[model samples]
Target: KVQESARVSGILHDIGKLVLLEFPDFFKKAKLNKQGRITQDSEYAVLGTSHSEIGGYLLGMWGLPNEIVEAITFHHRPSIQISTKPDLLTVLHTANGLANMCLMEMESDFGTYLDMKYLDAIGVSGYLDEWLSITHQVLDNTDNDQVQT
Candidate 1:
């Protein structure tokens, strides 16, 4: 169950971007000054909606589970999500940040590559090292045979 949740969360995390690109008219007036990088403020100001919100709404309409929808909705800044207990959304947010830190180099609108505040809020800040260690172990074990395409 945990593995499936992680898989679904990973697959749907950036689905909002697809929603935005598929419906350009919705963001037709959105400015390109930010190089199409839509942070919370920029997206709300220019497009009148963020991709996260759109994706969440679409997923809900499509009858996806609430946990998955919520995770995708607040994946960017889990601190903004309501709820004290750690949930799938929290995991997604942490994983998303870690993945971003590993993969992206471009200067982002939001300050840090990861949201430590969110991690701290969920009381998992102390476990980050363990997570990273596992991440490194996984990467070290991967082989070219893992790539299908």
Candidate 2:
């Protein structure tokens, strides 16, 4: 069940971006920072909200599991969570950080940063190297044609 939750949460974590796309000026108003990075503060400054909140609210309204909603809501800031136990939220957050590192070659301004404190609290901080290696192995196995340039 935890694995399933992680999968679903991962797939829907960015669903709010789809809704944001409806706003014609979203990309324009939500300007990237001087480093060409899109931070949560920048998103809030322009749109008055962040995709995490938007996605979490949507999932909550749909009556999905609270854990899933919480995971999506706090994936970018898992350290704020009160729970010290590692859960789907923790897995999603770690996976996101690893994915960002692996896709560093791509011009994506995802702005995902791993919460080292949270990882340490959850007793997984030491697994980062192993996780990164696995992520690279998976990426290597992916078909080049299916991978976007």
Candidate 3:
């Protein structure tokens, strides 16, 4: 299923965080001081590299497909990816944004770094309201299921 595939992509998109966690000292030092910019730029400012790049590099080294590596590498900045149509990168980015929105106050910036131009460029901006609605319903269901359990 496309949804299940996208969910897996979403899970792996942030595998960069695991790379960051591998280097606790470096991760501690890398903080995004900038207000409006995305995390990658801030990470570059602090550690001279970004978690996404590191994750991509590691995954590539392990012989993962280039497309998968590319998606993970550009998860935070999917707008920069060079492609004519929407692909896994677009899905991962939108899913990342939707999940963040569902997190509400639990996530910083509340998915603020989401680029409308990117979604517009990818031709998915028109469905954002629908995405949000579906995401919220899914989150609500998850919460209710957890409470019941």
Best by lDDT: 2
lDDT of 3 at 144: 42
Error of 3 at 11 (Å): 2.3
lDDT of each: 0.69, 0.79, 0.69
**Ten contiguous residues with the weakest lDDT in model 2:** 104-113
Ranking by TM-score: 2, 3, 1
Q: In model 1, how many backbone clashes occur? A: 0
**Can you tell me which runs of candidate 2 are displaced by over 4 Å?**
33-37, 105-112, 144-149
lDDT of 3 by residue, 93-125 (tens): 777777665664334333474667787876878
Per-residue alpha-carbon lDDT of model 2 for 16-133, expressed as tens digits? 7778888878787777755476677777898898888899999999999999999999888888888768888988888877776676642232234588888888898888878888
What is the Å distance of residue 15 in model 3 from its true position?
1.6
- Superposed by TM-score, candidate 3 places the C-alpha of residue 59 at a distance from the truth, in angstroms, of 1.3
